[model samples]
Target: MPSKIDPRRSGRSGGLRWPLVWNVAWRDLLSTLRDRRTLVSTILLPLLILPLFTLGMPLLLGRLIGGQAAERQKVGVVGTLPAELRRSLTRDESGRAGVELVSVTDPVEAVQSGEVEAALRAVTPLPTRAGEGSGQLELYAKLGNLKGQTGAQGKVESSVQAYNRALTLSRLEALGLDETALSPVTLRPVDASPAQEQRAGALAFLIPLMMLSFLLNGGMATALDSTAGEKERGTLESLLVSPVSRGEVVAGKLLATTLTSLATGVFSVLGFLAAGLAAAGLRGRSDVDAEMMQAMGGQLTLTPATLGAMVLIVLTVALLLSALLIALSIYARSYKEAQTYVTPLTFLIVFPAVALQFADFLTIGDALYALPVFGSMVAILDLVKGQITPLHTLLASGANLLGAGVLAWLAWRSFGREEVIFRN
Candidate 1:
């Protein structure tokens, strides 16, 4: 059994030594585990709250948004379609499909005031502007949510096209022109599975990104709470006075943060898989059901290399952020004050990550595969799409790990300085 030495005794036994690091780390970990708030935040929250908030919540919201956009659409009709023709149009067949015509107005105001989910304007005449050739029925949707706008537009356009086809045939017969003369070429669109198209629809992208970001975010909270939070609570000072080298202290704290981060990532991923499985079983024969459930039926899995890379990246990021946060936290007087320090650090960690969210999946290329968070996004997108290139994966993982190393070194150096650690 290891004996605890009192720091008060400055005899050789009281000198800072290797064992203090374990002592501090063990105490911190145990104390943290016992904390209701800490347990909830570190373990339970990721397992429970993240799935509900990030995955389930977003899915529900998407449905509501899609539903709301489909109901009571205000439409502006222009040109020679005629009011009688418009009145003859019955929405009974389409209304249940979520297309309710509210009112007609200027396209711009309808979109600006949110009076309509979209506006249908006649295309402006020109040598033709960029999208003008899309023809007389123009759709103006707020903020360019192309999916909803395009779906709604398709319904309206299909109705109009059918009406036009009927009228054209009547006119051709009355004018003694062959109906065949109106045809230039036969047209048919091949309807294929959305899966075959590799349609990385909104939810696919959102789920993974949400998982990665929240795992890191929640991990950050754990890191800060474990280290800096201890410092704020005055518990760290007690440990620092004991026998431990600064390096061991850093190593142990790094281990704790890495574990916390990995836990968060794993729990979040499990939640995603669980929800996905349930959704698949619930959807039963719906075309939107993910092919992953069938292809990898009765089992959810990640490739070993992919899982390794993800773990490495999350660990590196968590350690780097924790170190930086701890260094910053040392400057504060209390836990509350440390929170203020962490607020900006949180922003720093989160803001750079936003670039990942907006990156174009269709346009991803090598250069972006080298950019920091952008690189992670590209790598992850590739992973989910089942097309991860080992070369790109290594390069991105290397860059992120290398960057994290530099940040961790800086933080370690800061922690070593007594002036920094005890800054008033």
Candidate 2:
């Protein structure tokens, strides 16, 4: 009698096959989508979190700082002030008196009692005659109130400097000398970089760090659910018994996880952009005029090429994180156990993500580009700063893919082991 072949085992080629991989991947994707908890944790959470940090906090802080700056300041005077010096201390160059000067017996008590933001005490009486000696001026401010201290100290210093300049000019005229004779040269500063580059420098650290964090967080749930979750449900054994080879099964799961990770990353970027636009709109109502809005919009503008590079970086990071997460999840015996195992992995990702926020402190070199998480972070940071080098991009991308492949192989090997797959 001829040996009979089992139809269910007929497609087991003992190697990777595309059709089998696709089938497994599709099933995993569908299952993940149907699970509401996984969907929300991976997709919805990032969309909410990114916008809150990017838009809300900045607007709140801006309002607080602006309010503090716009309030009128109060200053106390301890001793009699000369007519000319009093005018100089009370009024600005534009003749607007922002400081309200009150005569106080004790300037220190006035500041301590919160009666004035700052106080000016005359160490010596002011000169009444043109040829009289200059008087000493002492300024006191409440050190506890930083905003009050800065404003009061700044106004007092400006007034003193103005008085000094005017007195110097008078003495120079008495000496039959021109004011400019004292200065040999004048210095002017010029910033050659474009406005866009300046704005990008401010945003470079935050954008990449948030993007990478979301990419990692977005894939984490699906990775754990697809592996450890299935094992906990007793469905992994049934899936393993299918005709598809173990490598094909692992590949399929990785593909699904990667897609989920990419989707989450894209959503996070969109959410952040939307939040920024909304913030701009709110600011335009009062703080931002049309000219300012136009200038800011131009500064924040991103080129299509830069956006493409960001997409590439996000995808590569997602692939690397998803593969590693899946391998870890595969070794876990239960869903709760997988979460316990993966929780610490987040810290690993966080340290590098935080480091990207200080990208200027890190050197961008071939060696950094060859490292795993650090390399991807540097590449993303360069892209945001508009300084991405093709060689560095290629190196970082290759390193990430190579690392993903290794983790994927480990996942496949774990799946092939009956003990690991069925561990409970």
Candidate 3:
């Protein structure tokens, strides 16, 4: 049996020794690696989740939209069609009349009651050709019922647009003007930055959130198991009685958890890369490829410096999260209790990740990069876009390391508290 450190030798023992740290860390790391739970969370989950989600999501959405469009919808038209339009136009290029036109006594009530998918009302007389009165047409659908309508709703809207355009042309021709008379200033969009198309794909924005999620999910198990699990199993006392300093013990657990999380993040990255490659392979083969390419945003244009910066940022975040989890876990009496305490930390990533979608609108300053999870996320966002801001990376990394140091210090102190260690 190991013996506890004496107060007389405490000063000397309090000093960190790498050999002792490694010994303690190795014991936990070896046990964690062998555990099936670690294998599932750290290896299998990371390797599959991203690719399956990124690749499968687009396909699923496409199926849903296409299926919605395919289902013939009931549209209520309140007014009669002009003789000319009734004869000449049954469907537009998108295959009009794809919907069934029915007469409804109450258009509003019909749509509200689900008697029709949508309703169209001509506020004025229908214009068949040039030299006619131009007016508005109202198309009504259940706006709040997005799920049931989805892509199929677009067909109803387009029919109304066609009606409005037809009326405009008729009015213009009546007034002796051309179609160009509809607008005094027409703006045509041009590609100002073709290079951007080659850099960040639409999917790149997800990288930051995914990376943080990887750290949290992959590291949480190991962190909880090492700290709370040891205490729960009544094994913490045996380790505490060893000659290892409390600081060294905390450092060792932090190191092990950080390493495990980093590995999981790496595997998650690999899953994304694999997804990208799969999309690239399908490029130009069919419309499926087009949809996937658009979903993926663009091909990876990452340079080594960018990858290195990502790796560096990932490491820092892992360290911080690992330490935070360990600290929380050390304070809990049981593994279940530790989980309840640490699970709320998910909101730390959830809020920033939700914000990442609107990144184009936000103006983030350099100092913001010094925030904990949010900072790393922003830096990684820039990195994913191939922006490679060294200052941002440096700021985020420095902040994360500083925060980790604080948390690790607290955990180290916690390790020395008998009440905390043996909490019932």
lDDT against the true structure, each candidate:
0.55, 0.73, 0.76
**Cα lDDT of model 3 by residue, 256-375, tens digit:** 898889989899878767776765665565554356456556334456898889889999999999999999999998999999999999999989988888887998989889998899
- Give the top-scoring candidate (TM-score): 3
Looking at model 3, the pairs that clash are 131-174, 201-297, 201-298, 202-297
Error of 1 at 78 (Å): 12
Q: Pick the lDDT winner.
A: 3
If scored against the real structure, what TM-score would every candidate get?
0.67, 0.77, 0.86
Better by TM-score, candidate 3 or 1: 3
**lDDT of model 1 at position 228:** 57
For model 1, residues 375-398, the per-residue Cα lDDT tens digits are 775676556555667777777767
Please report the TM-score between candidate 1 and the true structure: 0.67
Worst lDDT run of 10 residues, candidate 2, spans: 291-300
Candidate 3 lands at a TM-score of: 0.86
lDDT of 2 by residue, 1-424 (tens): 3123333443335557888888988888998889788678676776787666655555555554455445567889888878887787666443223577888888888888999889988889977444787788788886676576447666677777777778888888988987887786877886565544554435456666677777777787778888999999988877776677677778899998899889888887777666656645654354523223332331223468767777777788899999989999999999999998888876766787777666667666688888887788777666655677778877888888999999988897787666787778
